[model samples]
Target: MDRTAPPLEVATATPGIAWPGLPGPAGTSLLGLLFQLDRTQWWPAERIEAAQRRQLAALLDHARAEVPFWRARLPGFPPPEDAAAFEAAWAALPILTRAEIQAADASEALLADRLPQGHGEYREIFTSGSTGRPIRGVRSQLWELVWSAFTLRDHLWHRRDLAGSLAVIRESGAGKAPYPDGDTQAGWGFSSAAIFATGPLFSLNVTTPPALQMEWLRRRDPDYLLSHPSILARLAAEVGAHPLPRLKQVVAISEALAEPQRKAIEAAFRVPVVDVYSTREAGYLALQCPDHAGLHVQSEGLRLEVLRDDGTPCAAGEVGRVVVTPLHNLAMPLIRYEIGDLAEAGAPCPCGRGLPVLNRVMGRRQNMLRLADGGRRWPLLSSGDIEKLVAAAPALRQYRIVQTGFDALTVMLAVARPLTDAERAAVIAWARGKFGEGFAVAVETMDELPKSAAGKVEDFICEVPEG
Candidate 1:
């Protein structure tokens, strides 16, 4: 064994083997499962689906037996033990909506009978609740262990230098920055941290000014930086004005990342933008393929579906609603749950990963633009367009576009200085070009852009009627 390598025994080690100065065997064993799954990325797609079906069968059986909500709903449901039979039964189960889950007694959804079997203590987690009321759910230690495993899987898959720094800018209650530990034994908080060395983790609140964020990052000079797409876009623009020499990788999460935004960040930092698909309720769902542009579904952790409006499966290249079924999550199973997101289905990846592919995650439907012709579209804004807009208006700090009616549009901005008449006219002209010539463009200055309840900034919003 390499002396300087991660100071832990391999997964193939004997059952009771333990590292001299690290965590115990149980943590290593659990982490080893994730490491094992990391290697299974290239397993044939059918093989992965089969394993997922087996997991689904167990989840269904548990739900029917112990979950009061599922039991009452599935009174005739002793789903078959076999994979195909269970799949059919699973398909027959009604789709679960966020509203329905919120309306139902949350405790009734839990597998109470199985709680005492050493699955680890259960804890309540509230969803980000970006749209309406947040849905509350329970998670077990077993679930978190699996979650940590998947986190390790992402690290291994990306081949990140375990010793590099990871800086993140996100939301917080206390509005404080968590300084990174400069010690060599510092870990990234994954289950594998005990075995492998990890770099320091630095975090800042997203509410920090872009100038301050750049100053802080340049001072720290970290290897990787993580933030939401909107903020990253602003940071990229900031970096364009002031460069950072040490930042190597960009990890985007929380909000939907558009291709233009990814390109902007990559070009700004001269590094790859690794986008992760995840939610607060469910753990990591998929990650950007290391060798490819699209995402590789974390088949080991989730069973994802791209379905049409009618709930039928969508074909490759078709855009549809994203429905996810967490293979684990025995505490509160979210089977066939519509996460209220949209994505484009992708064909099998040439990288030889049988994991399902998503060509693009288009974000929430609420972000679409309403055209004057009664059509809704998610406009693919290019980097050049953004550059032109900012060039025309140097005072522009942030902006939001909303389509209030068929032909009327509103532009809200938080500016460093007031816009000149020519700058405002140029902005309106640019908006007219992108949206349509027939629409009326109204520009208004604001003290700040209003964020959603979950602290997300949507670049575009449409209020058109949906048939």
Candidate 2:
């Protein structure tokens, strides 16, 4: 494809209106950055389809040559190298099932063995065992560069003044420990040529005890704050909902941000609360646009596929698992990486970025609730939604809805204070209405709610279906 930069894109390519850091990334060079940006902006429709065909060929050829796991599965290569032929032979590639990924030998996935040699070698990361079995994978300095670009692009999308700002994701001082595993969603700001560009990434530990976490945020009155919604909600509840007028934007990531969570944090901080969908394994993926609508994928350097449980593509408006390919991760390129989440597909966005639009991202797979209607949906009947309906009511401190059986739900709750009859009725009404009246509701107020293995307050658990 002839990489051509249309005239309009020349200006739009650099999202920083004032061109913060005028020509960023010295390594990429001004010309090189522009060169790369223009190349990625949006491949012409026909060109993109063609490039996909080529990418498929490259992936198949590489897998056969370098990967034993795949070579043993694919019977033979195609002659014409067309999409139809590739599709017909896909099953031969052997499904890289989650079970296999969770237990695969890392040695089989790397390129030519022995680290792709370069700067400040670091230990390859193992998925902090978030889901019991630890997933081992490589992380490199080159990935750091790609991570920065994707993050900055998100900041630019927010129209934040980056020149004088800073991203608080890193430790303020050198030698400070990084957030363990996937907890690095704190303190991100645009780095343009302004006062906000202090570039002091710091850790605002969400899992820390509330007393200490309250003080941490009090001391680091960062203009731009980023964190998980659950942490932010807990903080707001702790601090008596104080105002931090300087906080222009607060971004929540890594977990579901319910309406109530957003309300509490926005009310407490007096800022626009934005949320992003990203992960440590794949870097930043998508972010909620300024319109507060669903997330828009950065289709430029990444390709995303929403697939059914059986590895087939999900039709539009259907929810399916998310698989992604990191186009820029040359060190250890991951094609069709199963990200372990579900999303609803929608039509092309009017945002006109060429990035695909995801109607809604269902929360973590395990968080989904099974319904009496012989169906299951997430964030659909979760405590996350119920929390919103009851957030403004100070009588409720905590709540949970566990599916005791196919047609039964137990609403275990904790009240910091006594609830009036109206409040009690409200809770019952919402529970039956939201969780389906077909299921019986039993409310049990307690002193505390049960915590998961990860020390998280699991408010909604479907005990009926064994996961």
- Give one digit per residue, the lDDT tens place, for model 1 in 199-261: 777777666777678877887788888888988988887886556777768889998898888
- In terms of TM-score, the best-performing candidate is 1
The TM-score values for the models, in the order shown, are 0.87, 0.73
Best by lDDT: 1
Runs of candidate 1 exceeding 4 Å displacement: 1-22, 75-86, 105-113, 178-186, 190-192, 240-242, 370-375, 391-394, 463-467
C-alpha RMSD of each candidate structure in angstroms: 4.0, 7.0
lDDT of 2 by residue, 362-382 (tens): 665655677656667673544
lDDT of 1 at 413: 82
lDDT of every model, 2 decimals: 0.76, 0.58
Residue 432 lDDT, candidate 1, scale 0-100: 92
